[model samples]
Target: MKHFLSINSCSSQELLELLELSIDLKKLYKSNKRVLCLAGKSLAMIFEKPSLRTRMSFQVAMTNLGGASVYVKPEDVGGIGKREPLKDMARILSGYVDGIMVRTFAHETATGLAEYASVPVINALTDWSHPCQAMADIMTAKEHFGKIEGLKFAFIGDGNNVARSLAFGCAKLGMRIEIASPAGYELDKGSIERANAIKPGTVVQSSDPIQAVKDADLIYTDTWVSMGQEEEKAKRINDFQGFQVNMDMLKAAASHVRVMHCLPAYRGYEITDEVCECENSIIFLEAENRLHFQRALLKKLMSSN
Candidate 1:
């Protein structure tokens, strides 16, 4: 729990504890109770990749907790490790801010910041993983179903960062996760093996989207063309033709199956416009949980107690 780098970095108990804390914080907020656990604390947010949710959620989470956040773009710090080493920036920021949150392209960048910072460092988003998003997603599922364990979660899209992080989170939380992707876009063997090690038989991989969602309680998807993959947009669309989560795919899933997507969704692409607005979609709730989950995370990581 020292740093929120990856879901695998946390034990099962820690993950459960975070979920509990997130629920408690969410309740307090909804009840109009003022939470000032991080009073006088400051967070430094570094963005190597542009984000709407990640940026707003962390900043607003800190504000909600009676704290402040400073947004640092690439040019603001001379490009994280360009003019100065990551260690230097980490050490320097630690002196000023109680915590650091970074949304970057390389996974190593986050780890590098944590390596030198005296304060806690959170991985807002990395090319290899999106731990916060996965945690919030689990929270959303728990809220919807009143529980999470033993649920069948199917991820039908690119086996990208979101899929990998969900696999790790689900394995730790006793949920079965099946990831479906095209041949070249499948989750890496090492990640699948690592997730399975946490809870044997928890992670399953498939090439058939329809078969993957069979009997699934939750079906998830993400954009096929991510930030750096824009050049491959046309090719990705062609490769992921049959992978879109439409009404037909939902029909194949369990009757109570709910849909989720990390936002900035491309309608008629990875998911259909109808599906995005459908009764089964909890995408907006999933997005809102990001604020709640990060508030709990900030309290956990920054509180002196």
Candidate 2:
């Protein structure tokens, strides 16, 4: 993989390979075996948008792979696209680091970095997509189900970046994705179309939470209000009144259906505390697999061509 800016950047076969690699790495980690695929590499991590999971996961992933990471705080580079052009920073970082991983507000910042960098660029997160999170989510599902094909995955809440990436990634992997969001918060039409092109009739969108979660093998939800949208909190709360993934919603899904959240969860809002703390919740497992999946991705992107 040259870059991992978006799930669409990878083919279905490539995603499966990454998932398999993640499984192997996870087993090795569990067995206390050292697998240093990126023995001598160095990754430069840039955080335009701060995150606990993104920062810790990538840092631990690099260390586990026998490599090191340099954390570039937001102020260090004057915040990407603020002090200078993303291309210039990308060019400069490529000369020093083996690979670049950046979490930014704009998706184009990631694209801009990839355009100029000589090394691989990974999009840790952006306003338009969070591909890394999608990878970890898929990895968690595959771990439970043994395979992801033909599984019904339902996302209930704001159709934000996480939801968008999940839709794209799930559809590409032959999993049908049903997303239920408020009218104004639906997944971008273009993204839905693109996903449909990959797996016809796999991407389904609705405004009803029941329709989205009905018989789904996995139920997912994310915060209705994201980092930069604090001003819309009250309005969003009112808009998403019945969208919470509570126990009642879980009952609509399969008996053994799993629950997933991408983290920094606001309990009683997007998801209730009951559901999040339930036996079916794999949220922590999903969070932990972020390290393994990302370690595999870093190894693939930085260790070789």
**Judged by lDDT, which candidate is best?**
1
Write one digit per residue (lDDT tens) for candidate 2, span 1-305: 79999998889888999999999989988999977878888999998788999999999999998999999989999878779987889899998989999898999999999999999999999999899999999999999999888888899988889888998897789888899988899999999999999888988889999988887999999998899999999999999999999999988878899999998999989999999999999999999999999989998888753
- List pairs with backbone clashes in candidate 1: none
Q: Per-residue lDDT for 1-305 in model 1, tens only?
A: 78999998999999999999999999999999978988999999999899999999999999999999999988998888899999999999999999999999999999999999999999999999999999999999999999999998899889999989999998899999999999899999999999999899999999999999988999999999999998999999999989999999999988899999998999999999999999999999999999999999999999875
lDDT of each: 0.94, 0.91
> Which TM-score value belongs to model 2?
0.98
- TM-score of every prediction relative to native: 0.99, 0.98
lDDT for predicted candidate 1 compared with the true structure: 0.94
How does residue 85 of candidate 2 score in lDDT?
Answer: 85
Off by over 4 Å in 1: none
